[model samples]
Every structure is written in C-alpha cells, then in structure tokens.
Target: MRLYKIMIVDDEAEVRQAIARKIDWRAVGFEIVADAENGRDALEKAETLELDVVLTDIKMPFMDGLELGAELARRKPNLKLIVFSGFDEFEYAKEAIKLNVVEYVLKPVNAAELTAILDRVRGTLDAEIEQRRNIRQLTQAYQESLPLLREKFLLDLLRGPMDPQVLEAQAERFGLAVREGAYKVAAVCDIVHGGEGRPALSDELVPVSVRQMLSDALWDRCGSEIVLGVPSILVATAWERDPVESLMRLLGEVCTECKRILGVTLAVGIGRPCQSLAELCRSCAEARTALEYRAVVGLGKPIYIQDMERLDRTAPEWDGHREQQLLSVIKFGTREQIAAMVDKLLSDGEGEWSDQSRVLGILGTLLSILRRCRLGEEAMLGPRGSWIKLLAEDAPMEALRDWLLSVCLNMSGCMDQRRVSTAKRLVEEAERYIREHYPDSGLSVDRLCEHLHISQSYFSTIFKQETGRSYVQYLTDVRMEHAVELLRATDDKTYMVAEKVGYDEPNYFSYVFKKRFGVSP
Candidate 1:
C-alpha cells in the first residue's frame, strides 16, 4: 500500500506535537507532511503542500479552522478534512459537517480512530488508480491490434492475382492455414427492399450481437474449416472430391437456415476451386457475378457457376462485325435500350446458355464485340484475362456471361473517352482479372506483373495512370462496391460477404469495409 500525505493544524504546539508523535503514520499507510501552530499558518502551508487529508483544531487565532477548511474546500475540492478540538460544541460539529469535513474526532485524537479513517481513504484512492490503469491498457491493446487486423483482412481476400511471398507472409502473420493445395470461394448476399439502393448492414446498424448470432449459425452449419471474407465467405475445403457440390450444399443450407431462423433472405454464388492463394481474385469475381444475377433472378437462392452446365464449356471466337454492333449499341444506346439489351443478352439461350459449349460461344461473341469496340488490349475478354485465364479451360457458361457483363459495366466509364482507348481496354482486362481470380487469397502487383509479362515498375505506373488509383486502392474500391450490393440485395452472413470479395479473414475484411463505407460489412 502507498502512503497518503497528511497535514496537522492546531493552535497549541503541545497538542499538535503530541498527536504527531503518538501515531505510527507509516503502519496505517499515511505520512504527516506539515505541522502548523495556527489555522492561518496551516492554510498558508496547505496552499504549498500536496496534502491528501487535513487534521485541524476548530478554534484558532487569526483564522478559525472552519475558515481555513472553507477556503481549502473551494480550492481543492478533492481533499479530505478531519476536525479535532477540546470543545464538543454541537454548533462547531454542525459547522464542520456543513464544510464537508470527513470526520470529527473528539478533543484528544485516538490512534486507532485516525488509523481507520486513513485506511478508508487509501482504499478509495487505490481503486480509482487501478481503474484508470485498466482503461489505459484496454485502449492501448485495441489500437495496437488495428493494423494487424487490417492485414489479416486483405490476406483473406486471397482469391486475386498476388505475389506468393506476400501471401505466405500474411498467412503466417494472421495464423491462417493457407491450404495452397485446394480451396473453394463463395459469395453471400442479403436481400433487402428489392435491392433498390445501398443498405446499411454494419454492426452499428444491425447490432454486433445479432451479427454474431448469424455468423455462428452459418459456421455451425458450414463447418469450422471456413474463413469469412466479408460480404463474402470463403470455405476452403479439400478438392480431392467434388468440392463445388459440397460448397453448393453448404451455401444452400446457410441460405435456408438464415431465412428460416432469422427471417432474412440470402443468396450465394460459389466459384470454381483453385489450387493456390494466387487465384482468389477470380473466385471473388465469380462470387460477384453470382450476386449480380440476383438483380435478374431475384433472391432466396444460390447460383453455382459449376451448376450452370451449358455456360461451363463456352469459349470466345473472334467476330468483327457482330462485336462492332454490340459495342455501338452499348456505347450509344439509351439507358432503357441498354437495360433491354442487357436483359435480352442475359436471357438469351437461357436453356442453351446452360450448356458449357453454347455459353462459351456467347462469351466468344461478347468478347469479340468488346474487342472490336477497341475497348483496349488489356480489357479482360471472358476467359482471356489473367485471373480468369487460369480457369478458362473449364469455367462455366454462367461464369463467362457474368464475367462479360461485369467487365462491360466496370469499363462503362471508359466508353466516355475514345482517345484513351488503351486505358479503357486495360481497365476492362483488369476487371476480368479481378473477377476471375479474387479468391486466390494471394493476388498482388508482383504476381499480376508476372501474369501480364510486364515489369513491376511498368505495371504499377500504367495501372495507376489508367485507373487514377493504386492497384490495391482500385481493388479495395471494387470489392467494397460489390459488398454494398450484396448487403442491400441479400441476407448472407457478413463473413460470407467477405469471402465473396476475395477475403478469407472476415474480421479484417469488415475493418476495411468499415473504413471504405463508414460502416462494417
């Protein structure tokens, strides 16, 4: 226990000395800092002394102890005071009470009584100090963990094109088991008000307790080998078997359970499996493509690219005239016309579109048109981009169609400028890469350069100059934008959303999503 500073005041020198000498101040955790023969002197000394408790005689010359106590009360409201004197005058005691004195000890102060008072004060002070320390520790811990949390989140979005070393480092830092051997990505969405506008689904908006309940429910049903990627959920299960089927089943169960128990609708999109973290971005794109289908297909369902048999085998073949016509229509068409065209193209060969061969055929047609529009050489044309290129051999038709539409919309702004046609093309290509490989959990600039056959410095410079943002910034923006769509249109778990956006770590994804949208995913 720490000792508290005490001050003694009395008109009689003998009385003051007797009290100070009689008490073993250290035994009870107190030390007398000053002694005064009069109230006036005591008041003056008190001003200069750092005292915790004051013991004073009421009746004194010049200024009474009452007056000194009143002045001390006004100056140091926190200081404790005790009154001691020969007179047992009721009036004086009453006055002491009015002055907020701690206690009134009779004429002769007893050591036992004084010790008790000091002990009580010590207890109070210790408690207050301890509380302050705990608060400081808690604040410091939260601040220190912020950066680590952010890195963990980006690593979870491992489905994009990224450097191997960077991904390995992130996995090690975050305690993530990057099963470079096999993994599957899934996109989760929550249906809200018919998907009319962006919705606020943050912890503040929906309550963290409720979000936890939803997350636990999904995890309980999906198994523990899953990582929530924010606004998307990535379930990394073994691919030795039919992983897509298993993923689809888990997604279906989650959607059904969420709707049945929480009274909220959900939709899920499962991407093709990848062998390593480098292909996460493509997985993210697949998830987003699944989410976009909600606008046309409605909610309370799951869209598995693997299940769309027809679109699974389609491939793009060059067609100059048809490609030109599609570009002209997209560039010059009215919003209504564009919407109608979009609907037609999305619905076309709805039956045949399910066929992988026919789906590839349509993708080929769309890409040719996109290419002829001179959208740029870097623009992703279906299975031609980096991330998606990895999956071109076996990707589904629905994935291809979804990828085409997504690329078109993502580069829609580029169409506004024909002079920088190359920039627009690169944006398109980047979009394709992002969609197809967002789930690799290891996509980054170094890896992107390797895929594009360009130098790191050159790639960085061109990507920034064309997109007006750093590669990471652009990727985050796109992920967050898609996250907003999922939050508004479906009732998928927050972790599921994280995975959909190429994030394997849900917590980190939520942190970044909060920073970008001013709210958590």
Candidate 2:
C-alpha cells in the first residue's frame, strides 16, 4: 500500500482542521501533507509538494475552488480534486463538473462520507500508478526493439518511395538523422555463399560481419545505414560531388578489407546519385541493375550503372540495353510512356525510319516479352518470322510503328488490370486499419505501410488515387468524425475529447478542429 500525498484547503482555518481531523489519513492510504486557508495559499503550497489529491472548499477568498482546480488541471493533469462547501448551489455543482471534480460533498464534514471519497480516490490513484508502470514497461520494450524498427525503416527507404516530410519524420523517429546533402544507394551483393545460382549455406553471419565492416569504414566519411539481407547489404549514404566515384572508392576498400579479413570475395553495385532521400528507391533499383553487370565488369569490384549506360551509348548496333529498355516499357511503363519510347526507338531523330538493325532488335525484344507474358508470338507477329517480311517492304516504318504501339499498349492494359485489383485490395486494407486505429496518436503512414508489408510510396500512390485524399487527410477526417460524435453524445471536456480522438496535444487538436469546422473545439 503506497501513501498518497494530499492537501486540505479552505478559507476558514477551523474548517480545514476539522476536515483533517475527521479522516484517518494513513488508514485511508493518504497523508495530510499540507493545509491552506484559501485557494491561492493552497496553490502556493502545491508548488512545493507533489500531491495526488486536493480537498478544497468551494467558496474561498482570493481564488475559488473552480479557479484552483483549473490551474491544477493545467499544471498536473492527473491530480484528483474534490470540492466541499457549506452551501449547496447548482451553479457551484455545475462548475465542479466542468473542473472534473471527483466528489462534491456538503460541510460540516462527515467522517464516513469523506473516508469513502478518500477510498475511491485511493483506488483511482492505484489504477493510475499501475498504468504508469505499464507505460514504463512498454517504453523499455520499445527501446529494445529500436534496432529492428530502424532496420525496417532502412528497408522501407530502399524498397519504396516516401514523401520527403514523412521520410524525415520516420528517420527522426528511428534515430536516423537526415543530413542536408545528396544521397546515393549501393547494393553490396554476391556475399560468400549468397550470389545468384548459389545456395545460402551457413553464411548468415557473413552479412552481419560485412555490415559491421561497412559501418566502421563509412562511419567517418559519411553517414550510412547498411541493411543486411540475403545476397546483399543495401547501403544508403549521404555524400557530395563525384558521389559515385567516392562511393566506389569507399566500397572498394570495404570489399578489399572484407576479403582479406573474412576470406570472402564480394561485389558492389553503385547507383547514380540522387538529390533527396525520396529518390532513393530509383537509385536502389539502378543499383540492383548494376549488380547484374558483375559478369561483364568481373566480380570483386564496384560496378556503376552510369558506366553501363556509357557502354550502351557507345555500342554501334542494337544491344542488350536497348532490348531491356523496350521490355521495361512494355511491362511497367504507362501507355503514353510505352508509345513515346517506341517512337523514339523507331524514328531516326528526323521522323524517318531508323536503320533495319535497330528495328529488328526491338522486334526480337517484343517477341521475348510476349513469350514471357505467356502470349503467343504468332498471334502478335502473324506466323512467327512474318515480321521479317513486313520489315523488308517499302513503307514498312508506319506499319511497324503502329503494330509495335498496339502490342505494347495491349500488354500495358493487361498489366494494369492485375495492378488495379492489387491496388484496390491495398486501399481497402488501409482504410480498415485506419478506422480501427484512429484513436492511436502514433498511427502514421510508415506504421500503416509496415502493417500492410508494402512500400510507403506505393501505398501512398494507390491510396490517394483511390480515395482522392492523402493518408494524413483521410486520418484527420476519420478522427474528426469520431470527435464530433463524442462531443454530441457525451459531456466530456475538450481536452478529454481530444485524447479520445488520437491527439496528444489538446491545443493542436483544437486548432485542427477549428481549421476543419471553422470553430474551436
């Protein structure tokens, strides 16, 4: 049984003394810590003692019980208040209710009634203390899970797009401070036994060791979050001009040290530099593409996507790069994007036909894509090799252009149907989660994405397209609806209502309410 510190306040000293004498402070799990003649005096005394309860009279000179209770509520929101008075006035009772007074009793004090009130206060205090303990335990658990949460954030950064503001907030929450500079992404792939066509056998510790080494190497040069995964360690770095080259040098050293120290060889794929963290997903994708070129650049080195682009630019004939670009457009690009890319590939800058070799390369790429999409090539090209006959005829440019556009657009339509169904499911889940968790003040887009096991960028895109509002806007609307209902159905105060509707700061909640409804809460 813990002792709760309490104070007694009344304008008359005799009444205060009588009230103190009527109760067994210790027996009721309380201590009469202080006594005062008026609300002002009690408030002054309150500044010195950490009190759990205040028993004060309703009509006190200098300041009344209502004023003192309001001030105390602001200073110590959890403090319990009880008002007792000689006169029974409905106005006083109304004010007491507004002040969140736990009990309003009439004087002269009755030992039995006062003791019962104190017992109830004791029970309330006990519950509050237990709640505090639980929150402390939760806080400790959160600290313990910080590392895993931070890893998830890094993975999110690499896997999908995050708005700049949301990205900064999430980074700050995870203790990953965002610096003011450009960022670049790198994929440290081909671990000891985690490369393509290789089995991941008893090499889980290799990535952990590589992450530590990478951290140690980049700790002074730049800030890096190295995410350890099978087959690769994704590194996002804040670096400056000559970013790719600088990263290549740093990664080369990490690779050398890794091999020399751990008896393992690895390759690094570096992406192009991005101006902001939001663009990291693109950089990450490019980095993964760079990893595929390890066979050409040889393993145990840092391969850059820019270097591959330079090679593609210098190639005289149709190459793998062109084939990849066309296939990507058909599979993932929008209809407009697919059309523009095909037109660019077929036109020789002056709207004339490009050379036959380039047209042939694009045709072959489309054939491969059709096969991959499980569509019959003959259905697309009319009896397999007949596309070659069409290519060799006069005025073949228009025919080839129209045929290629139709095929790419049709593929895009098929892809979009599947994508739209997935997007609808994602949006539905998001709405359900928001509705269920609207009262949670910590609910955020990052948390929602984590719950859905998807990227923030993808989720945000689909959610806005489907709902015609951002996640924050939608959450705000939901909170406001519940808040309006609570206000209409209950006598809860504005602060209480705010807490129930997922706002930790009552002032901010009121501001939002006013902004949305044009009236203060």
Candidate No. with top TM-score: 2
Off by over 4 Å in 1: 1-156, 177-181, 190-240, 314-521
Candidate 2 TM-score, true structure as reference = 0.35
Q: Residue 289 deviation, candidate 1, in Å?
A: 1.1
TM-score of each model, in listed order: 0.32, 0.35
Give Cα distance to truth, residue 21, candidate 1, Å: 90
**Off by more than 4 A, model 2:** 1-319, 328-363, 370-402, 413-428, 455-469, 490-500, 504-511
Model 2, 419-488: lDDT tens digits are: 4666688899899999999999999876897787654434655688899987888999999999999999
Candidate 1 global lDDT: 0.57
Global lDDT for candidate 2?
0.71
Each model's backbone clash number:
84, 0
Please list the C-alpha lDDT of all candidates, in the order they appear.
Answer: 0.57, 0.71
Clashes of 1: 84
Predicted candidate 1 versus true structure: per-residue lDDT over 1-521, tens digit per residue = 55878888987889888888887889878899998866656775775566778988888765678888887875455567888766666466656556548677776678788778767777765654343334344345434433656445554554455677876776567654344334544344443322333322322232221233334434423322343345444443334443554455445545543443334566655555555555655655555544544542346656654332122333222234445445545555555555455445555455334444544554566556555444554554433466357345777655655655565554455554442454456556776787677666578755665565433333444467777886777777778888888989999999988898778878667767876778766
